[model samples]
Target: MATNRATKSGFAAEAQRKVNAKYSEELAQECLEWIRTITNEDINCGGDMDNFYEVLKDGTLLCRLVNCIQSGSVKKINNTTMAFKCMENINAFLETAKVLGVPAQETFQTVDLWERQNLNSVVICIQSLGRKAGNFGKPSIGPKEAEKNERHFSEDKLKAGQSIIGLQMGSNKGANQSGINFGNTRHM
Candidate 1:
């Protein structure tokens, strides 16, 4: 049973790694470039999953990235080989990312990076961070977020909408059960 569980775990990890690999090279490169732009630090990764994970596994780069967007957000980055300290850095970065408009759903857990469980999630988090970079006067990564469209309506139009049947409620206007027959009533 334990062996089966281990096999399943291995399969799941391999699958996640492959899915992470599917992100466009252009996107990964763009994200790396954006990170350099914001942090003003040169990263040595080749934008591949392995390189990306290695460069960021310590959470130093991530802390720096978030700090670039919001200064003093992490307060202090523990630059040490200790595992717990590294986890702290990641946690700080995640929290700061949340404050910087990177949604909680977009953030990755420490284990996701530490154990290489889902580096794709880390990449996605960085992409989201890049999108929000523009708000903080930094160059954005990936595509720009869409702008909202505001519509104005007169009071008459607003009141009229309330009386109309909603699409979800559906309309029976052209839909009729008229002359309906289940095969032939005599055949029953």
Candidate 2:
């Protein structure tokens, strides 16, 4: 019946909406803004912003590159020979990593754009790479210095308040007790 078909179609539409809503609005906006700027200035992609926004939000690097190539950007390469070469290089890198005992996931494959049509992967890879690279360069601190910097929450653990009686004040012994002791506190 016509009513049955309509109900089924409506349900399908609602399901699609729910699936799409899983992606955050902030992420979608970031992708959209990046795509808008890149397509407008960097690549002369002829299509409307909506299409590019949607594709970029899905995060398919190959699709983005293809879009750029179609836009006739000098910076974007679109040859099958080049793609094959890149794939070979990627395979070599993976093999080298494996030999080196590097635990990397071999996720990327030769992208056959013609066969696989959907570009639904989110394109947040660049941000993650930046974070990893940022962490890789910093030198770690020693445990003692780290302990000195550790914060204590208990009132008893609080450092003793500033004391007038000390070695600086010509006292032989250092202040023995440690607590919230307010001793003859004078405002400078």
Q: Highest TM-score, which number?
A: 1
Q: Which 10 successive residues of model 2 have the least lDDT summed?
A: 112-121
Query: lDDT per residue, candidate 1, 126-156, as tens digits?
Result: 8998888888888887779878999999999
- Whole-model lDDT, model 1: 0.79
Evaluate residue 9 in candidate 1 and report its C-alpha lDDT on the 0 to 100 scale. Answer: 49
- Clashes by residue pair, model 2: 58-121, 59-122, 59-123
What is the overall TM-score of model 2 with all chains considered together?
0.27
Candidate 2 ranges beyond 4 A from true positions? 1-11, 32-76, 79-188
**Prediction 1 TM-score vs. true:** 0.78
- TM-score per prediction, in order, is 0.78, 0.27
Residue 68 lDDT, candidate 2, scale 0-100: 39
